[model samples]
Target: MLKKTRVAVFVSGGGSNLEALLQSEVSGGMPFGEIALVVSNTQGAYALERANNHGVEGVCIPSRGNSGFEEELQALLMARHIDIIVLAGFLAILSADFVGKWPERIINIHPSLIPSFCGKGFYGLKVHEAALERGVTLTGATVHLVNEIPDGGRILLQKAVEIRPDDTAKTLQQRVMEQAEWVLLPQATAQLCQELSEKLSEGV
Candidate 1:
């Protein structure tokens, strides 16, 4: 049997996107990927619970006030032989040093399309708020390679969602997740996993 790529999902708060990825693993949407570990910067994050429910290992590294945060995180990823890292609503900004170590091995899901309501200070419902405030008729999600620049990496996939007339920030956020983020994240992860599996098979 071919080996499955080991994946680590980093999350903060609710981890709705992590839930989608976990579901995909079982449903064959991500056949070449195995969610080997879930790491959260916040202790007691609900995402850890979601990982546990699916029988995947989850840990908390506690980024707040911890200078060794990335060091500890890197050690854990190495110990588990993590092949890819997925940032699903993880709030902390990773240092360039840590990001350099991963190169294109890390991916992140942004709430809005790049060069739109993305970059620093736009996260969670705030991205949706900006789009609504700007009166954009269409806003969507983007899954892209994680780089030192926030949401500046090469795009992998994007799906557009229409902004309804009655949509508030909260409502728009939910719709984007349901219609775009949930769909694109899993597809992109699977694509990377398949590519990585191929590279590994060739001993690259």
Candidate 2:
């Protein structure tokens, strides 16, 4: 039997994206991938609760004011044999050293197209608010590789969402997730997992 790629989802918020990935796994959308762990930097994040409900191991490793945060995080990931790391609403900035270790193995879901309302200080409703303020008729979600640069990684997939005239920042945010982010993230993850599994088989 072929080995499944172990996946770790990192989250800092409500983890709606994480939930989508979990659902996809159970529905057999991600045939080569299995969600092995869910890690949150915030102690009380609801994402942890979702992980618990799914019977996946959930861990909290606070990054704030912790000098050895990355070391500890890397250790936990290694122990779990995580093959792919997905950042789903995870707010902490990974150091270049840590990012280099993962190379193309780390993936992140951003709320907007790259070189737009992305990069530093742009996350959550802020990206949507900027899109509305700029009067762009179209904005979307992007699933990309995670590099040291925030949201600057190579794009794997993107799905556009229309900006409605009556859309507030919060409303626009919800629409983007439902119409684009949730869809693209799982698809991209499954693609990566399949590619990785094939590569591993080739080497065997």
Candidate number achieving the greatest TM-score relative to the actual structure = 1
Report the lDDT tens digits of candidate 1 across residue range 62-82: 999999999999999999999
Q: Which stretches of candidate 1 lie over 4 Å from their true place?
A: none
* Predicted candidate 2 versus true structure: per-residue lDDT over 1-204, tens digit per residue: 557889999999899999999999989999998999999999899999999999999999999999999999999999999999999999999999999999899999999987789999999899999999999999999999999898989999988899999999999999999999899999999999988888777774
Off by over 4 Å in 2: none
What is candidate 2's CA lDDT for residue 84? Answer: 94
Find the number of clashing residue pairs for candidate 1.
0
User: How large an RMSD does model 2 have?
Assistant: 0.9
Model 1 residue 44 CA deviation (Å) reads 1.2
Prediction 1 TM-score vs. true: 0.98
**For candidate 2, which ten residues in a row score worst on lDDT?**
195-204
- Give the top-scoring candidate (lDDT): 1
What value of lDDT does candidate 2 attain over all alpha carbons?
0.94
